[model samples]
Target: MSENGGGTARRRRRGSATVAARTGVAPNSGDILWEIFLRLPPQPSSLPRVSLVCKRWRRLAADPEFLIRFRAHHRKAPLLGLFKEYGGWVSFTPVLGAPDRIPRRRFSMRIDYGGGAETHPFHGTLLGCRHGRVLAVDPRRREVLVCDPITGDQRRVALPPEFGTCGGAHGAVLCADGDEGHVHGGCHSSPFKVVLVQISFGPGHPPPFARVYSSETGVWSDPILAAEGSRGYVDLSRPSTLIGNSLYWWLHGSYLCNMEILEFDVGRQSLAVINSLPVGDTVKSKGCIQIIQPEDGRVGFAMLSYPSLEMWDLKDDCGGGVAAWVPRKTMNLDLVPNMRVTEASIVGYAEDDDAILIKFNNNIFIVQLESMQSRKLYDCFVRHQYHPFASFYSSGSAKRKA
Candidate 1:
């Protein structure tokens, strides 16, 4: 007690010294508080920019906990309306209550490509979306883009040089793991794998060929050549849709006039010809292949037969000797003006949610399956909008489960 107080005092000093020696410094109240803040879930709105603040903050912002919280809050968030004016796309978060209510804020950004005042020569449509990316192609430009709306990240890929001289119009099919299939369905459990199929017209004197691209491998590989014997007169103007790993197109060949479904095996990097829809009398009257996701976690390809919607289960292959075409459900919308089922393209499906989005004559409509009711969402056409496409981002957490 004379030199250094009591034995207890000496032990306390030694304990503090050991902690300082191990950690390189005495723990301060401020340091402990900062650590606690780092472990807490971040605010959703500021997450993207917050990740760029500092290394420590970036890690915290990217934490799975933060994403979960962000997505949970985003689910109830109001829908965002985006439109093009003066040659650029602008986004506005709509007011929840009234359609006439003014938006609280506006986001202005320019898309690099647009049709402008001229009508787009390409007639292809958007097929699928994954990892916040949208895939679109224009036959006129003979170009393809994998784009991210939120980050404005785009990768432009040109068609093969031979595709230019092929004379036949061009079409593209974008495929990715489904939101539910990736999030809930235990399919292939790899997060980095993505399969995209680009079907381009082969040079004159031969059949059309498909180029398959795997995100796992940056290079595109040639798959087995498709039989052009039946696709000589096929129109390339209309885009193809990807259901699962397969791309379907309406082939109007001289030999057989029908919709051709080309299945590209993502794992094998091979191609196989699936069954084709029966040919109808007229070109315009023929049924076009459209992919729709039913709420029950199944992908359905609906072939529009005038007044009726002919649906098929994409997951099941009608046995080799069996008839594949089985009538599932039909909706008669002949009474709706300009709403003929054949003219509208199925843009999105939330089957479990009992809703589907269709694009017809450049207008977007939301329809309820049970009630068979339709409502126009918005008029996306502005200044001859070329190949207008829309895709939503599933939280990265969702892809991780895939």
Candidate 2:
């Protein structure tokens, strides 16, 4: 009887060990790796933290398959942060992705003129990011730097004659149109072809003529005259916006409330006047064109109407010309006396994505476009302290820390 009981006890212990091994409680190397890959999605933002949990997780996170999956998931996530300030600039990143969630991973970097007692005049901010590399210009020193935010690797390029200016300059990352002929073969359109455009304003000039830069050829081209007979009267407050290869700027004419849209053909290196928005008496008097991209992916330009916010949509024009001003929606401050839209500007359009971020009264507000629910992201100064800009990049690399 004693021998039988001992044998039974040994059998029960063996069964318990078998169950633990099968369920991964005492996981093997393969089980640990598979588990890490399975936990990658939904919590991609937490990858950086996961890697630090254990040695097995760190190795699994660095796996090629894990990185590919992480990149695919991160591309669709929303990220909002300040990039630069003191140069009157701000940017937004509509889509951000990372493959390796290692320490010191940066999606973007900002270049600004460091303010000091000497107060050196600096050009506007410039961002160069594509194919895992970025370039930025320092206006105070008149230099361009090539940097890898992930590796902390950087190379500085001296500015050519055209890039140097005391007043300031603007820079852009331009991508060439891959579907020039609409070739839709097995060839997936390569989104990597890109160029850079920088415009420098001469010192003490009201309106600055823009200097062009091309990353394809890596040289500074000739100066682009803002418009015929209106060289020094254009509005340099807002940075140029790129739709495809073309760059758009809002040029306010010298005449009272006159405005024209300047479209720069980045590929052809030419410029043309596209269309003009109708400036109402109230908007004309305010001396500003407030363009906002809503969460619905619609681009609306608004101007102060005192009590009412007047907005117009440019998407429905059908290229016939600038569409006639139409009122889509209005926010009335009179109804909510305590709530005010301050430092109000449309950062970008998420388009049916439920959430939209807007800057009001120097504060950043993330509001649901459908539900109208809202939350304050941070303090005004903390939100806009860095010059904010927006860009979208492909996802396929390892996850990296932001």
Candidate 3:
């Protein structure tokens, strides 16, 4: 991805209406053509077809600004696809087409594991995914693999201080460029932060050892302490969400039965905790959690309650009075008789849009956040999170689909 990162606006193709006016095309102006191209379905497969229409359209289709606008325009039509393990290898499937429709599983692509032709089994679990990229960890190999599933470009980073024989806590967040003191959501280079910690029990807790690695800095920071009683223990199995400058260890329950999200402010190098909705006895054993971003871009919580899914958006009261999560939407599964989700698990969270992927043992469906409507994705067995095609854009490359 070389030709990237100067913060250049090379792909911002604007002024289409003016050009069309000069060409004297009345009824269908260049602006109209441009809008049509911008409105082109964001299926990575359709862009090339639009590009083939003409050189002018090709230039607009490839423009970063246009791509960004297209995403925003269709943000409501979120559900891009699923990244799941198939036959011992991870692959991507675009089960989602346009909004308001549940398309069949038309096709899928095998994502190459760029860690060389490894004959060994990669027992790597997905840590987090965003912007068309994924961060996964192979605990056995003591390393983490960051890859762009769309392009097959990947890199490996070793675990910090090793996960050696101790109860360790770990998670990765696909954060944007937060090094410059602000969240550069689309400043371009897709960077992420990985956290590793030693879990200690009993009194004192010895400050709980921790370390972080940033893709931007390309090095692990000096060990930082997460204080004591931070959350009884960190579940490395669940992925974290990177919102603004904070990296969250989400969905952890406390002794009091309150769901919580531990905030690891990547910029301040500190830790804080936020409370989520309370758990009732009925769904206590049956429920699960997933961290997703809502329409406003704040961290949202999706709690799985057997027959229904509850969503709440977190709000921060800047004046230091009180911050709480307010209930936003609810999705009832009882409406869909075929979706007998006895053991539903959160498969994916599209932070860039309002769509989320939740799956039962064999059935998976994409739920739009706004409408809370669910649609089945045939053959989609939940899979790892991260991506809606937004992360594939880099300064050096374009889409591979035709």
Candidate 4:
């Protein structure tokens, strides 16, 4: 059993004197005990479990100060796992144990919904992933759930009233709770918010609707229009990409298949369309477009054409706030001889390490940044739905530590 992000907190509320009395130490010695716990292994699988040693330990471990320090110490761990949900089966196969590799357990959501739950591993569509938590819609499509697969904690999203069907609700984003202003820890006790991207009906030119639910308020906000400046529905199937505090939607044109990128400010509850990828003269290039956060912690666009994949970073020109998209990495499939042997497609962007997940025939591979090599993880059959995601534990973790 790993450390509980917050659930393991001992409610005993022992006094400092009582704690010191139990340990046969002076009251002022509690600081020394806390200092010792500060040295606990940074592994998420250890600290919480170790806290159960005693009430005093639990108190020390759950201390916001300790959590902050603990997070700072183990902040450099890379993507520890890749979760895949396909063919009505959703499983998180541990990937962090690779000898020279990427990272988890074979954990699946065992949901218990209102004493009327679905299957052990809920057949659901994974909409978005962040902070080690996933937002998924059940197979029935009746509701959206914010789930922490590791901790088995889930909160059903509050939907907009008379919102009708889930037709236009293509994407869901989970805003986790942590500290006072930000999301930290493992999302065990932090109050969260769920935002649903549900499109509005009618022909006249209606913007996509954003149905938001806040855990603290215990209610869903009325449907609000999203991606205001752009028109036409987004490719509902494609998961929305989050960069900084804004979520982006890759909107496609109706007839000619035009592509547009729109940014939605989560805090402001507003949307603005941004520049699209520079396909240059090859606008009709047969490939897929995905928004990725590259190694430099900036939003990037990755376009896959045949055996070649090119990534472009969204950068600002020298002038004040002049937005520009710049090419960053280009990997030719020729390096991987087998890539030419069959059909391949870009799966999505791995935001944690700036790699691209690609599907070649029956297997899934991550295009590596170093050496222009590739790492293969599993064999994803045609019927399975694959969603590769990792928490914000990269170089960003160090700076984001609360």
Best by TM-score: 4
List the global CA lDDT of all models: 0.43, 0.44, 0.56, 0.59
Model 2 Cα lDDT, one tens digit per residue, 61-91: 6554444344443343323233433453323
Against the true structure, candidate 1 reaches a TM-score of 0.52
**Model 1, residue pairs in steric clash:** 124-239, 294-351, 295-351, 295-352
Give a tens-digit lDDT track for model 3, residues 195-253.
66555544665545567878878898887775545445666555566666667765344
Name the regions of candidate 3 deviating beyond 4 angstroms.
Answer: 1-32, 54-56, 63-79, 85-93, 97-121, 162-167, 178-192, 201-204, 207-210, 251-259, 275-277, 292-300, 311-331, 338-348, 379-402
Question: Which residue ranges in model 2 land beyond 4 Å of their true spot?
Answer: 1-45, 52-56, 87-136, 146-150, 166-169, 174-217, 221-237, 254-256, 267-270, 284-289, 292-310, 315-337, 340-359, 366-373, 381-386, 389-402
What TM-score do all the candidates reach, one by one? 0.52, 0.56, 0.69, 0.70
Per-residue lDDT for 1-402 in model 1, tens only? Answer: 565667787788767755643343433444453344434332223444555678876775565443333333333222333222222222332312343322323122223465353321223333333333445443456655554444444465675665562245333434344453133111123223333333443245544455655454656666456554333334433334444454445444444444565555554556555555543442243223454543332245555443555555543546775545444676764425755343555544432234455556566665666677877766644222222223222233222210
Summarize candidate 4's per-residue lDDT along 242-290 as a digit string, tens digits. Answer: 7777777676655324556766677888756564557654333323567
Name the top lDDT candidate: 4
As a TM-score, model 3 comes out at 0.69
| Every candidate's CA RMSD | 11.3, 12.1, 8.1, 9.1
In model 2, the Cα lDDT at residue 11 comes to: 89
**Clash count of each predicted structure:** 4, 28, 2, 7
Find the 10 residues in a row with the least total lDDT in model 4: 393-402
Find the number of clashing residue pairs for candidate 4.
7
